[model samples]
Target chain A: MTTMMLVPGFDRVVELVPGERAVAIRNIPATLPVFATHFARFPVLPGVLLLESMADLAKAALGDGHWRLRTVRGVRFRHFVGPGDQVEIRVEVTGRTDQTAQVRATARVEERVVATARGLALVAAEQPWEGTQ
Target chain B: MRFHLIDRIESWTPREQITARKVTSVAEDCWRPTPAGPVLSFGLALEALCQSATWLMMLSTDYRLRAALLAVDEACAPRDVVPGDVLRTHAVVESMSDEAAVLAGLVTVGGETVLEASGILCSLMDAERLDDPADTALMGRQLLGKGAPR
Candidate 1:
């Protein structure tokens, strides 16, 4: 596989300017191997990919720390991010308390909001046994 | 090809019980290395369990599976989803109608509840035209070298 094709779910780290805001983008290329089987005419990016994009954005917003989601309710899919459309996703760390942090994120198609998610991030003592496999 | 997502579900038999499982590994992008060193993303674990439950529920039906996750209520993740953790998901179909099924899923690790979710899903088309030529032909290539579940 070429280095270009190695990014399975993510395409490129488009724009990351500092402070708590970043604009990251990924494309659902029709030629992708998953598209070959994910679906036929009405192919769409899996919700899991949406979550991943959100999480990766969180990772950037939260430069260094361990945060896990306690809840992510009401994640609505207003529209589908398909092969031809470019998913311009943005995430901003809206608020932060001692133990809890709130993030506001959105997936946009140039001007319209394709999807949006309000995520909760918490800071806790790192786990003892993490990746054992 | 068999759907690995729903492979374990073989019985079409319906009861008051249903079972599913989700395993988080390195490849799933849930694990990360911290200076304090690696952590598991609990959110991913919850989503996996939800997907597993969805796979089982959809497999029980004979419609064109175009399940859309409408909502996730009462989500709680208390601990990190470590690699060894096996999320044994259990969903008792609380309610069902002609088009949708509401499932209550519980994610457990070491036989302990780590997360719980109430999810809603729906099928695309009716059973009779489930294999319509246009539909099958379009969704067929994706299932190349594979057949429908019995």
Candidate 2:
């Protein structure tokens, strides 16, 4: 299993639509040091973290080979997701070429939409330090 | 509660523009892998843009309104930024209203545009909600920089 170094805790793959899409769940831990400083009283999860969660699921949908995000469009963040929330992330492969693929993704807390994004993902050779295991 | 996304304001023009920089540190990075070469994630770059826009909004409102990022469009990061790279972010206010403001932001390293976006920032609260307006203004001044003594 390839680990998500950029966005950790992406191991929970709930449903795989096979070759086209995937759904995963990640729990936001309240203990994140960010909460202590990000509006200490409110403690809402940063929007960037929410976006990263969706990007991680997009990577899982791509499956295999190193990839990079090239473009993200029409990202709309709705509800505020806070600590201890279990976010369900879904990603659908929209288009692809030999070197790149397009994906539309969303993050939800139950039925409430937390965020959505559409972006291009490109396959690239593993960075030399990634190691050939 | 400051996130410190922007280490220090490099330049500021009240309601018109702002430029800042943040260098990636292991303690602030989510990734820890060799060979990956200190990659800065796209999401983090976008956050830096939004943070800069937030400051522009706060300054324009005299620190009276606290804005939250409402939407991002055409956000493109053509290249990745390494750990040691100085991520310089520049934000220019396109327009502003009582409820929201539009901003054009670009992030660069060594004068090359690595990431760019057009984002909307909407005020979630204003001085009318705060008991002490001075407290908010104080923070506003801290971010906008002190004015010359009269």
**Strongest candidate by TM-score:** 2
TM-score of chain B of 2: 0.77
Cα-based RMSD of candidate 1: 6.5
lDDT of 1: 0.56
What docking grade does candidate 2 earn? acceptable
> What's the residue-level lDDT of B115 in candidate 2?
90
Give the winner by lDDT.
Answer: 2
Candidate 2: tens digits of C-alpha lDDT, residues A18-119: 447887888878887777756545667778777777766676677666667767888887888878888888889887765677888888898788888866
TM-score of each: 0.70, 0.83
Model 1 docking tier (incorrect/acceptable/medium/high): acceptable
lDDT of 1 by residue, B1-150 (tens): 111232243222342335655555555544655545455555455555555555444445533353455545446666556655666666666666556666677767787777776653433334333234445433332223245533
> Which pairs of residues collide in candidate 2?
A129-B35
For each candidate in the order shown, give its overall lDDT on alpha carbons.
Answer: 0.56, 0.71
User: What lDDT does candidate 1 reach at residue A116?
Assistant: 75
lDDT of 2 by residue, B1-150 (tens): 246577656787867888987776656554424245566677788888888777666666776665677677768887777666788899998777778777888999889888988765545456435225565455545544564223
